[model samples]
Target: MGSLMHLIPVTDPADPRLAAYTSIREKDLTSGHGGRFIVEGKVTLETLLTRSRFAVESLFLAESRLAPLADLLAKVPADVPVYTAPQDIMDQVAGFPMHRGVLACGLKGDIPLPGEFISEDKPRSGPLLLLSDISNHDNTGACFRNAAAFGAGGLLLDERCCDPLYRKAIRVSSGASLFLPYAHGGTGLDMVNAVLNAGYTVWAMTPRAEAQPMQSLPVPDKLAILLGAEGPGLPDALIAAAEPVRIPMSAGFDSINVATAGAIALAHVFGEKQG
Candidate 1:
């Protein structure tokens, strides 16, 4: 019964109003759609409407999804348009079969600098997760989910990292990317230096023999856990610049997936905080 529940029927996949929703898969891989990112699925849509810091530009849903999402759609702002289409039109617009039957375009507002995001003035609870050259969307999304789960203050991604706002990444994150405050730019070393200058003790995660075990170190008042892409791992200079820590694994196995490693490290920090 929300005022915004008046659904605008979208019959044509080529409609100008749904221009942002057209060829979504291609757009997701290419450039920003006028500072807007697509959020898909019921959960992500709910997060977009209810909890995300980003503004809901509009929503596109299949006719079948209207009833199931009625309560959630009721929360949409009056200015935001709610467009409904047949499943075929939705699929045609998205360039794929519309299994989820829900999608929303969100405006990416101002992205803060790394230093600004982790500023001393900002009230934060747990360590910040810093990512370097993690180009995989799944890993990027998983990292965000893990960061949110463990109460991490926020995330900082180097320029080489994939877009956490990518549609698949946002969906994989279970919408964590929508709410977790993150800064994605600059070199890995740049992010490390920024946090160090911000008075956060940096722990560069590596699999090197010389790196200390993560659990052995006491968590700092402000900590930043740095993780790099899986195969190459953290750059040596970056590792040398910070305190190197490793999750001890069995013989012959040196490392795990970057996101998994990040989860373990964040969990260790979370455990220490609870203790």
Candidate 2:
């Protein structure tokens, strides 16, 4: 099942052949349909090829970087094209300093149906984690870290959330973002209802004075924690539908990082031992 090698030496940075991945700049790839995703470096690209559900259209690498990734390339089906571009040309095409020396273009991974990502087939003794409007890849990535670390069943986000497979998020999660399942789409209300219908209590995280303290709450057998963006916090609509819970803070201290709060809340929800 080894991929066929095109071995074309690309010199011109503007080569039309690079069009498939040239516009894969961070901003353009963040959220869209028909937007392609590029996996850079040999390790990550290979990992995505093997682990993700996305279609792999092409993989490009520098001639020098090929030997080390040969085994990985061999895993790809023979029909898939593996292109070789000069290292300098690749650096130019990427518009970034080249370190790993290889990159690829593939169809983006589509978010699965919310139900499939958090279904009963999902191993869950407790509720899930719902991420809404927290588009910062780092925060979204950290939330995923906390979700898996504390044994939350799945990671759920709204349509507007950052791409989980975005470069920064993937780097921050150190590849764990791909290990667990996540879903997107629907308004935050729809996400809450989905979890509630699945018999999980939904607690939306917020720092409002009216919110119940996280430390004092009795967590349900299944729980979903709704986290908002950094400064703005959760929307009022989501707050209205979900139980608003706060991680207690000293009077002077205002709020915690959404990701940090996620970890603490997940720990409490799973009844996991704390540091």
List the global CA lDDT of all models: 0.88, 0.74
- TM per prediction: 0.96, 0.84
lDDT of 1: 0.88
Model 2, range 1-275, lDDT digits (tens) per residue? 24535556677889887776564553556356675666666556766767766677777788787778777777876666777777777777777766777777667656675665666474654457788888787888788778867887778887768877776676576555666677877777777778878777788888899999888887676778888888888889889988888888898887889899888888886774332
- In the order shown, the candidates' Cα RMSDs to the true structure are 1.5, 3.1
lDDT of 1 by residue, 1-275 (tens): 57345679988889999988888887763245457789989999989888899988889999999888778888989888889999999999989998989999998867776766766477777899999999999999999999999999899998899888899899889999999989978788888999998888999999998989987888899999999898888888899889999899999989798999999999888988898
Per-residue error for 158 in candidate 1, Å, reads: 1.3
Collision pairs in model 1: none
What RMSD does model 1 have?
A: 1.5
Off by over 4 Å in 1: 3-5, 29-33
Alpha carbon RMSD to native, model 2:
3.1
